[model samples]
Target: MATIFTPGPALQSNSSEQNRFMEKLMAKILSFYDEQSLIDVTFKVSNPTAVVPAHRLILAAASPYFENLFRGEQGNNPVIEINDIDSDTLERLITFCYTGEAPITVNNVGAMLKAAIVLQLNDAINSCVDCIMKNINGYTLQAAYTLERETQCERLKQKLIEYEIKNFMEISRGVEFLSFDVEKLQRILESDNLNIPREEDAYDAIKRWFNYDVPARQEPLPHLIACLRLTQFDADFLLTHIQPLPGCELLAFKAISWIREPAARTKISMRFTEPRATCEETFLVICRSEMNYKLLQYNKAEDKWQEYASLEIDYTNYWPILKDENILFIGGYKNGVSCNIVRSLNIRNKTWQNLPAMNQARRGHRVVELDGKIYAIGGLEGNKVLSSVERYTPSDGWEFVSSLTVGRFDASAEILNGKLYVLGGRNINGALKLVECYNPDSNTWTSCADMTECRVSLHVRVHKGHIYVLEKYSANQSSQSVERYDPERNTWSKICCLNAEWARIENVFSFDNKLWSFGHPKHDDISSVSVYDEDNDRWVKKCSLPNVDRYTYNIVPVALLSSK
Candidate 1:
């Protein structure tokens, strides 16, 4: 009958529809392989002999190797010998050809990778490589390295190398590390990203690797030693450990010569003197908002302030000392009185721990860590400004070390040349230009050169063998000045004057290897952070702190945080 045939609604060629069709088609194809239907090729793999049947059409479509192999001759159920790939890997590869996915895990990734390489299956190769990288650990690292080298995969090689460097301390002790060839080890040692505590540790690692099979690795000692940052080693380390080595005497002496001659230090290789990526530096700002105490971390690179921690404390003006991974908030004023409550916040775990209180209830004091001990300098206790100083050690807790020459609060202090230098602060008689230096070795105070101005609530920072003091704004002062103190010369010099816009500066500190001052402009609510340009001798405005105003922010540099 000539009946009109009405076409049903045509399906949409959208991405979702295409994806569903492909998914169903893949399921049907995999089912065909599962049922061994339409199979025209047999792969025979040897190590533990087995056979896998796959469709020649599907195999050729997925792999260039199979496509090129079957282009000329048409054969039914052609048998192919695979001596390199085992039976299980061949099955996995065939399954991936049907379904576009395989069970690529760490254990079988190397085998599958080799099989994919042999068959020239690019998708399977990528899947195998991703699995190896994602699951790489101390156990599988060396094998992954070898697989990368065999395949010449640059991405896999770089990932493995970075992992090795970051985890060098632990991996250096493993037997797998010993399997690294001299070239590989040399490349790792030459990297500045080796997360080692010191250059000596790299040398020690090389020594251990060499001593494992000395006869085999001894000839490469000089080559490996050259990769070390020899200038970082001291004379004692060089003469004691390096000179005794069989072939490292020349390297040791040359490093020692560089260390002895300051001018000749420039001639030392830059790679050898570049610092390792052992620790990170960050600015931790503590401020009081309307409701709670907020801790902010200034991301200098991004020019952004990230809220790090929030504490429900009824105190303001607490000092944060970066001890390992913890920030020790020492003493603060609570309810119109100074309290000696010490609290530590572990930045890694975001846990708060209460530490032993200081000997005196002191606020407006500065704390410095020197030689593994914490020294709490002068601060006021109630109405009386105290001249007492307390030192804290793990063994002794808090004890009186030495008293300051003058009792004052809101003063600035820093450690220089193993001595504590306390700068100008206001006493009961108003501000004083007095500076005192306390030597821990002698347990006595010595007078240092005084600042040019009487500074109260000033910020003191030590940089490059000098102490920098930036004064707070006052109604009487016309301009805020930054003074530099030479510890060796025992003299004070004015480095530069702060911009009039920064007259109401709140805090000045060292962060990211530069002297920075942060405050708001006069009659402004937004706080500005500026980095001191040493060469230009000017404060270049960088960015503004978030959620913090001019009057309430307390900022400090927290460089290293312990994983523990």
Candidate 2:
């Protein structure tokens, strides 16, 4: 009955009208199958109404392979399975196929690589590898290496080795890609034309592979040896590579290749030079009220100095006397009295205790510790210049030591080469250039040598077995000339000079093998504190001191604890 009705309705319509209607329905069905085939091959092949053949659908899906066939014509429609490939990866792959350009983003690299591998697309895979190697940094190395490993792509791994991808090797603890043939790796390491990336990971890998504990009878990898000449690499990286080779053979090769190669030694030396302390580690000039006479503990990581305890006595003229695990404060003017009081605050216990007073009343003096004994050198005693010196031992208390050859005030004392070197000071008659040395063994003072320039209120620091002197020549003029003194030869040589503003200040201290000067109070216009570089023979400006008020006072830096 239904067939009879359908035939009657078809017969009732005009022939041309019926023909147009059938054509329209067929067009709609073809369009639906085409759209579905573009979405997924499985969806198209499984669809009950799909009219397109499965083989044709598969060919359309791989349209990039037959691109030359449809170079000019409007060819068969491309049926890319969007679900099979990630949308971003699919877009990138399509762009690469069309224009031979691939845009690599971190998000789509993995999916793109997987799709390229699955489709057996060699160019696409290489493009993905190139993008990954080019953009690899510390953050992305691990992910990239993982992708390469999973794909089992030897070409990608070789590209990584060629680039010397640092990020991948630096953080990798042990041998990785262990399954990779050592012979191929050895060949790569020995290659002359290959350029390896100066990354931390590459250095670590090269070291682990070549510098084994037991000596290998196999010939050394020449390419790895050549890679060590890369000066752009970190010293720590070079050290890592050469240190494991044992007996300094690899190190010697590195030195010859890197150091002796045209100003390379200078560059290496400059890079390894110690860094200066920041404002946080700098000793600020704190006033009497600010000087709590507390045991201050230095936190290295935090780069901070904090007071641990407070003292009852005033700290006006109380300069940091002797510093060890405990800090000793002696011969400071307390209230109106010039106190000869000797006190120490244990940094560990955070407690203060009184020791015996000095043999004589002394203020404006410097206290130096030599061989576990404290010596209070020349200072003001009631407007009289005193040459008196006293030694303080914990067991025997304070005893009179040998006095200075000349009585002076506003002087500076430094312990160098097991001897006390007392330099320029303002006697009753302006500045004096007298440089004297005192030997504790002989209990005597001998004039060794004189400074080239006369300076009062100057800063003296020792660096690299040489003493550096910084001072102002006159009230209006300051000298930045740094004179390096060698104790062994008893000779002086001029290193690079700093700016006048840095040398003018009295607040200077040496720590961590670098000389540091605070910002000059008279010259606050200068924003940076001065730091002398021994290797470069120059002075650099670091972050300015936090509190500028402490620029005028004597700054002392004590090594709280150090592990060698």
Candidate 3:
């Protein structure tokens, strides 16, 4: 009895009483929703009716339409009617206005969104957009696209475009792609980010879409055919495929003009060439020393590493196999001077050819390939770390493209979603955690998220549309952690920490649909290869380096054969 009287209010003893009070208050508020309490409003639209028992003051305060009506001279009105919105959707919208939560589903989202828009409910609008996002796909896109257009939903429209562009090739094969009209077909083919590896694939896909209902779709042929990159087709494919198609006369003339006078052809709407299918995915390891360049590729048939191709030169450098017949070796310290000699070797003919030298000579640079073009990003040009960038094409030789936003040597680069991504590497300022993305379509470089830790000489590879980066040089921690970047989410997460420390990771590439990092294991002099098994989420050792003789092979150079 003394303990109870000791405090003004026994806070601990009444904690349960507070919960009981809230529960009773919520129940009382919920009872107001019943018609028995007092029905005040009715909403009708689209053949549905909602009879809601609610206080006019609460409803007016939550919704703009109600506010506009009640703020007038007749604020005391008891009954109100709302139109242009169905009863079930109005119920959800009204409930959301009261509880600050909207109930929405794919089936009723369109109706709910219309009600929310009429009532000026932003939260409900966002909720509906999210509902569509979770459920929107090939089958539902048409309906979703109509709803977005009707309501002027910017976010949903962008997402629809992105989904179409991101999965263009795959979407073309879907049943819904079979249902696409000419305008929808143009939307997909016109996107610069379309993942069409070959132009002919897009042509064939459009033809299939056109032939679905020939009489109805044939009229749009000229409009649709104008978008194809007909110039990318060889004479045979163009003559046989494009010429034979009806209503392709204008497109054929444009194609011929593009070939004869490509620079001066103004009427022809030539498409930016999509990446060609250059080669099958393969792994190549390049070992460098004072005057030796030995390349080894994973021989899948023998299930082991074998000698691929080699070029003896006077430098340390970066070289990756073109994944088919050719391999490239670029700028490095040649006889103690930064040199920019770009060399290539044909595996089939065993011949070597030297392309045009880079705009500048640089050592310790990262060389990457995208869409069959090679780019030489930042490296040490003379005594200064250079941010200058250059591109090489077989037709044009070497042309300087955009420079890197940050100047760093020995950075890691990879191509994902048709963009060049450069990750951590050392500059004169030291190791960088900066991540930047270069869009080939725009020729612009923009910064992305930094790494979990500052790193230099890291290894990055794209596997199944995700970029995986491994810490090759970091003093902060030796946990041997790896970071994975999802381009879709624009975020990075620390993934598997390897069992063995990644020391002097000479090369890392995707092989057999799995990420493999090669170098000497922790505290071991001999180099080995380990595969990251997604099923087990651990690094599984596969085999040793092709060269067990450590005496000659010191610096290992690597390349991923992503294009043919």
- In terms of TM-score, the best-performing candidate is 1
401-478: candidate 3 lDDT, tens digit per residue:
888899998788887656899998888778798999999999999999888878877777665457788766444346
lDDT scores for all predictions? Answer: 0.76, 0.57, 0.69
Determine which window of 10 residues in candidate 2 has minimal summed lDDT: 271-280
TM-score of each: 0.55, 0.45, 0.48
lDDT of 1 at 209: 92
lDDT of 1 by residue, 1-564 (tens): 678855345544466776788789888887888898887788888878999998888888888888887785544447877788888888888888887889988778878888788898888877777788777763377777678878876656666778888778678878888878887898898887787644556876898899899888778888888888776655656776777787989888888888677688767653465445553356667776564677677776787887777777777656667664567888878899988988888766778889889889888887888655788888878888989999887678889877888898888888776678888888899998999998888899999888888888887776546788877774445566778988779999997566556656777765454677777666666777788797787778776776443234433323233333
Off by over 4 Å in 3: 1-282, 308-310, 321-324, 474-478, 534-538, 546-564
For residue 230, model 3's alpha carbon misses the true position, in angstroms, by: 23
What TM-score would you give candidate 3 relative to the actual structure?
0.48
Query: Which candidate tops lDDT?
Result: 1
Model 1: lDDT of residue 308: 73
